[model samples]
Target: MLDMFRYNWQVRQDWFEWCRELPQERTGGMGSILATLFHVANGEQIWINSMQGTPVIVKEGVTSLEEAVEFTELTQSITEQFLQSWDDELAMKTLIKKRRDGSEITFTYDKIIKHLIAHEIHHIGQLSIWSREIGRKPVSSDLIFRDY
Candidate 1:
């Protein structure tokens, strides 16, 4: 699973590089490239906050791709630190999250981390599709090619 995390980190780096080449006009606002990428990065931070008993800081307004990359780097650093303390006991520890409707759901740390990776990949696929529509070749998502 740690290897998977490393692989996803590399994938994210590639996606950010691909996004940097795109026009700034296409990277802002709702449903835009940077918006989606920011959401993925923010989601990672949210989960890390929950696990670490820290306050979730909400960042508002439009952000540049460079800023998004910086935020992602920060989130990844926090997550990596959290993972440094990972163990069988920590992996099995469960956390309950309350939804907007006041419903609660339970998940083990292992499952939550997996969901975080999958969530980002899912959004990255959307970026890839959008990239194609704009006549750009998107970054590769091939896992086998990754040396990680």
Candidate 2:
């Protein structure tokens, strides 16, 4: 699971680099590249807050990829610290969250990590589509032959 987390982090970094070649503005109403990247970074932060039972404060006005990268690195550092002391017993523990409609959802710590990873990959698919629309090749999503 830790390996998966590390791999996703590298994949995100590669995507950010690929996005740097594109214009900062939106091409076809899909969304601006840098804005989408910010969304991904913010998603990690929201999830970290959820895991820590803290407030989920959404940031705004991050219009540059460099700013997005900074936010991502900060959130990743917090996640890394959390994982460093993780154990199987904690992974088995579940967190229950109440929805606005008064419904409840439960997730294991391990599953939360998996969900965050999948969330990033799903957005990467969106980035890939927008990249193709703009006549650019996206970073490869392949896991094979990766350095980490």
Candidate 3:
């Protein structure tokens, strides 16, 4: 589990760096670069909050890439802290979350961890596509590229 979290964090850091390097034209869009980063960071927070059974509030209004990077780093740090404090019993327990569309779902800590990584990968893929469409060089996303 710790390995998974570390790997996820590394990949997220790579994406954040790529976002930071995006030119102003590439970063400008419906939600813009900052907004996309906020959405990604908020998604991580939502998963953590759901697992902890805390009140989940959607975050908004991030205006700068630097702000997004700061928020992402902070949230990742908290996630790492929580994982460090996790016990076997807690990891095996299930968390129930109520969706905004009035649906309820249950997941264990292990499932949440996997979901968090997978969800980020999905979004990063989207970002890569957009970057390619805009003629910007996309960062290497394969895990092997980061293995060194």
Candidate 4:
């Protein structure tokens, strides 16, 4: 489970790093490439916190992919430590979460992990389209596909 999370993080980090060489306009929608990265990283933190029934921890004004990566790493570290206390049975327990609009739903921790990875993949697809608009190759999503 943790390995899946790490693979998703590596893909996102690789995309952000690859995007750094391009002009800001290429990734400007939804702010810039850095902001989009932060959005994805922050959402990961939000969902992880929600799953744990903890208050969301937020840091504002992350202006670079480097900073966003650091924040994401920190969030992942904390979340992993939290998860360490749980066994397989506990990890599968359903979590009750509230939507911003006040609706409520339940999801298991594994389900949330699936959602987080899928959400990142969806946004990365947007980044890939943007990259192609400017005639750039999208970063490879497979971590083991490259030496890294």
Badly placed stretches (over 4 Å) of model 1 are 27-30
In model 1, how many backbone clashes occur?
A: 0
| Candidate 3 lDDT trough over 10 residues, lowest sum | 25-34
Q: Model 1 over residues 1-148: C-alpha lDDT tens digits?
A: 6677777778888988887776664643346777887888888889989988898868973457778888988888888889889899999999899989999999999999989989877877887888888888988889998887
| Candidate 2 local lDDT, 41-101, one digit each (tens) | 6777787778877787668747677888898898788777777877998788788888999
Candidate with top TM-score is: 1
Which ranges in model 3 have alpha carbons more than 4 Å from their true place?
Answer: 25-30, 53-58, 101-103
Question: Please, what is the TM-score per model?
Answer: 0.89, 0.86, 0.80, 0.80
- Model 3 residue 65 distance off true place after TM-score fit, in angstroms: 0.5
Per-residue lDDT of candidate 3, residues 32-77 (tens digit): 6556657767888888877776666556657777777788887877
**Residues 96-126, candidate 4, lDDT per residue (tens digit)?**
8778999998988778777877888778877
Identify the candidate with maximal lDDT: 1
Candidate 2 residue pairs in clash (backbone atoms < 3 Å) = none
Q: In model 1, what are the clashing residue pairs, if there are any?
A: none
Candidate 4 lDDT for residue 6? 70
Give the whole-model CA lDDT for all candidates, comma-separated: 0.82, 0.77, 0.72, 0.75
TM-score of predicted structure 1: 0.89
Task: Find the number of clashing residue pairs for candidate 4.
Answer: 0
